[model samples]
Target: MMSKEDKIYLELEDREFPFSYTDHDRKIVRAIVFDEEKKFYFVRIHRDDSFGKATLIETSGGGVEKGEDLETAIQRELKEELGAEVEILQEIGIVSDYYNHVHRHNINHYFLCKVRSFGEKNLMPYEIRDFHMESLKLSYEEAIREYEKCSNTKLGRLIAQREVPVLEEVKKMLLIN
Candidate 1:
């Protein structure tokens, strides 16, 4: 059980699928980013890996580096992954889930942000070859449909369980739904 006090909560949220991981802990960040036009950005990835090419769409951001604050890590991740400069307007709390297949646990912090500007994306090496990604700005209805499409696959189900609620929460907060 996670409360507001613990910096690193060693627990998991009740999930649709039981989540567990080999690694004890990791911290990550993601942003629900909106541009001036009101469309949100989601990364559509074609993952070429041992399992073959699998398509997935996910909100952007990544692991928090040691010694980095949450705000800085998120900013850096957005710049790298989305080529985006953003002003984070609000914190959307956290989500905890396990990747049983990989034996890893993720403590995902989410935020709601407004895009300030666009720059060139700086994806990491593997992100280029293994996960060739394209950022797509979609309307809320389109995002919901994409989530449903993603949930049809095994891995996609897990991602949807972890991320869709964050999207839903933000949608409600913004009164767009």
Candidate 2:
């Protein structure tokens, strides 16, 4: 069995809305992806609607599919988002956050992964037209700066709050500057 200290846990409130009900819980698998050269990989999403116009940087991940284990889910997510084959280096931890507007309680499972190769992305039609998703590769400092800069938006603030801590833990695990 794993010890408590082996992972970090976070509970985030819904800062955007004051809804008292969470109708559903979404179990997601995310990765802090890095290459042999030490560059990190993330997804940059551009939105221009109810959440407002903003470009947000976030880890690559999605909801865990039915009957899939966390490891399988993460590998599939990285492939779909980053278009890269990866080796999961470690399980970073879990972050439980609420999106009151959507009534979603997200239980995010984070992993540290090393890229093995890159290929074409299998992006969904909506991901292309709606989110305008693109891959971003940056050094540790650059990634942190991007996350901070993106925090100006409401959705961005929530994402930053959820992801930045996980990124910091990965940095410590990788011994990166």
Candidate 3:
């Protein structure tokens, strides 16, 4: 049997880029993994010369590694970054955007996930500075309000638009509101 890593690599290697851009389009993915406790996990990335200052962003799971599939990439990313095992429940959606003159092709796959366990979040030394696990007790309205002051990241816009309804659903699931 092929190893999980091998299977993931094969899937990514076989994928072809149907669309092209003048500038190289880098493929990326993100996850919206949540637990039964209604807490959402996010990463606080430290900015450097290439990026900027420290900023809070949604827990993203992606990178078009040679021979990796979308699902495999996400699963790998979740485990790598959060040090947690997650079971993908459903794919929420996808989004693509361009920023800073670079065309970023992000096949953002939002998944309803359950964290089986937690350990020390293993962040890439240069990519992340810290992380936080927040509860959904904060109202959607409150979340939207806080996002506005958060550097106006794409994740913020998603929350403002109520694109990922899992946050709301989780609150309801736990009877928080």
Write down the worst ten-residue block by lDDT for model 3: 6-15
Model 3 per-residue lDDT tens digits across residues 25-125: 65776666666755566544434333333344455465768888877888788777777788876554444443332334334444556677777656665
lDDT of each: 0.81, 0.90, 0.50
Candidate rank order under TM-score: 2, 1, 3
The regions of model 2 sitting more than 4 angstroms off are 1-5
TM-score of 3: 0.63
After superposing candidate 1 on the true structure, give the runs of residues whose Cα lies further than 4 Å from its correct spot.
1-21, 50-53
How well is each residue in 85-150 modelled by candidate 1, as lDDT tens digits? 999997777888777655677889888899999999999998988788889899988988898897
* Models, CA RMSD each: 3.5, 2.2, 9.3
**After superposition, candidate 3 runs with Cα above 4 Å error:** 1-22, 128-145, 152-177
Measured by lDDT, the strongest candidate is 2
User: What residue pairs are clashing in model 3?
Assistant: 8-68, 9-67, 12-68, 13-67
lDDT of 2 by residue, 60-131 (tens): 999998999999999888889889999998888889998887889999988889999999899889899999
Model 1 scores worst on lDDT over the 10 consecutive residues at 6-15
The number of the candidate with the highest TM-score is 2
